[model samples]
Target: MRAHHLALLFLAACGSDKDPFAGGADAPPREDGGVIGDGSTTVDAAPRMCAAKPSRVVVLGDSITACSVIGGPNTADCVSKKVADYVMAQHGATAYQNHAVGGAKLSGIAAQLNAIQPAPGPALVILYIGGNDLSPFIFQSDQQAMQGYQMIEPMLVSVYAAVFAKLKNTTTFPDGAVLLTNTQYSPFDDCTASPYNLSATKTGLLHKFNNKVKSIADAQGADAIVVDQHPAYLGHGHHYNVTMCPHYAAGQTPWMQDTIHANVAGNVGLAAVMNGGVDRLYRDCIQ
Candidate 1:
C-alpha cells in the first residue's frame, strides 16, 4: 500500500527463487515432468491422472482481486471468488487460489507467481494489475508528465513479458495454460465527485495501456488472453458518482468502492466478463 511496501516486495522478487511458495531450489523434481509435491522428493510410482479440462484457477492482482472494502469487512463477494465460482461451474475446476494483495503493483507479481504450486494439467491464471502504476499520473498535466507516462508504458510491457517468460519456463502445465490479463477501467473518470479532473487524459492513458496489453498478449501467442474490462464497465456508466455511492438503479449497482476499487456488483460484473473470456478460451482449447 505504501512506497516502503512496494520496495520490500521488489527486493523479495529479486530473489524469487527463495520464496517458499515457489518451486525453490530445494523443491522436489517432478517424476516425469509432472507436478511437484510439497518438499517431498519421493515421487508417486504411478502417474497422477489429470482432468479433461483445467482443474485449477489462480488469481493475482491488487485490491480488485483482494476486494477488501474500505468500510466493510472482507467478503467472499470479491472478484476472485466470483471468478473461481464461474470457472468451477463452467469448466469443473475444483481448485482455486487467490494471491491478490491490496495495493499491489506489477513489480509484486513475481512473489505472487512464486506462491503458486505447479499443476499437472493446464491452469487458468488471472492477472489484474497496473492500476496502481497509473494512479501516480492520474492528475498530471504537464508535458514532462506525459513524457514520464510514455516512458513507463514500455517498462510495464517489459515487466509483463518477463513474468510470462518465468511462467513458461518454471511452471509445468503440460496441457498448456491461459494467462489472462486485464486492462483497468477508470471509476474516477468523468465522476463529478472525484478530485482528479483530468478525465480525458486519464481515459486516453488507460486506452493506451490497454492497447499495449493487447499487443503483448498477442506477442505471447494463444496462451495469453487479455480480458478487456474497460468497455464492459464503460457500457454500464460514464461518470462514477460516489455521492450516489453504491449507485443502485433498476437492479444495476455501482461497480466501484471509491474511485478505483470495485464494489460487490462491480466484482460480479467483472467476473461475468472474465467468465466469457475463459469460456471462449476453453472452447478454443477443445477445438
Candidate 2:
C-alpha cells in the first residue's frame, strides 16, 4: 500500500477529525474485504456475495447519539458519523441519517421510529438509548431506586420488542436491514468524587439494563445486534466535571466531555464498539 492509502486507513481506524468518511477515491478498492473502524479485517476474507448492503444508515437515541458534547468543526468524530462513514466505506452505502434527540427516552422511541421516512432500499438502523430513562434514578435512594429500576426492565423489554416488531413489519427493503442496539456506559459510574457516587444499587441496575438489551437482541434473532459499550468505556477515563475541585480527577485525554456525554475520543471509542458489532453481523449473517 502507498503512504497516502496507509494514512486513510489510519484516520478511519482512529475516527479522526479529517474526512474519514470521504468516498474511497484515493485508495484502491479491497478485493478481500474492507476493514472496520477497529482495524480488524473481515473474517470471511472473501468478497461479499450473499447479502446486499444497506442503501442508508439511521441512528436513533438520545443526546449520546446526537453527539451533543463532541460537537465542533470536526463533526466526523461523532459516533453516528463514524458508523455512517464506516458503512459507506465498507458497504458502498450512500446515505446516513440520525434521528436522535437530546433527551429521548425508551418510551419515546416509537415516535422516533414512526417519524422515519423509510428508504427505498435496505437501511441499517442503530439504536443507542435507555440512558436518559435510567438517568433519573442515578441519585435516588437505594431502595427507591432499585424499585424504580425493577419497573424499568419490563418497560425496556416491551419498548424494544415493539421497536423491532415495527421494523420487521413496516420497512420495505429489497435485501433486508439490521437493527443494532447498545448498552449504556456512564463515566460517572467510575467517578469517586463526592456527589458522583456509583452505588451498588446503581451498578446492579446498569447490569440489568445491559442484560435486558442483550435479551432483546437474542429474542429478535438475526436482525438485531447488541453492541456492548459498558465494558469498552470502563477505565477509559473519569467523567467530565464542570466544577473544578482539587480532589476530583480531570477528564482523561479523550473520553468524556461531561458527566454524561463523551468527548471526541470517547465518541471514537463508541464508534469502535459499533464497528465491531457490524463486522460480526457481516461475518455471521451477511456472509
Clashes of each: 0, 0
Q: Which runs in model 2 stand beyond 4 Å of their true positions?
A: 1-51, 72-74, 170-175, 189-195, 239-254, 283-286
lDDT (Cα, tens digit) per residue for candidate 2, span 242-275: 3343223355354766555677888888888888
Local distance difference test, each candidate: 0.56, 0.60
TM-score of each: 0.71, 0.73
**Residue 199's lDDT in candidate 2:** 47
Candidate 2 lDDT for residue 87? 85
Pairs in clash, predicted candidate 1:
none
Per-residue accuracy of model 1 over 4-47 as CA lDDT, tens digit each: 11111111011112221233234454332121111122122223
- For model 1, the stretches where C-alpha displacement exceeds 4 angstroms are 1-52, 70-74, 170-175, 189-196, 235-252, 284-286
Give me the overall lDDT of model 1. Answer: 0.56
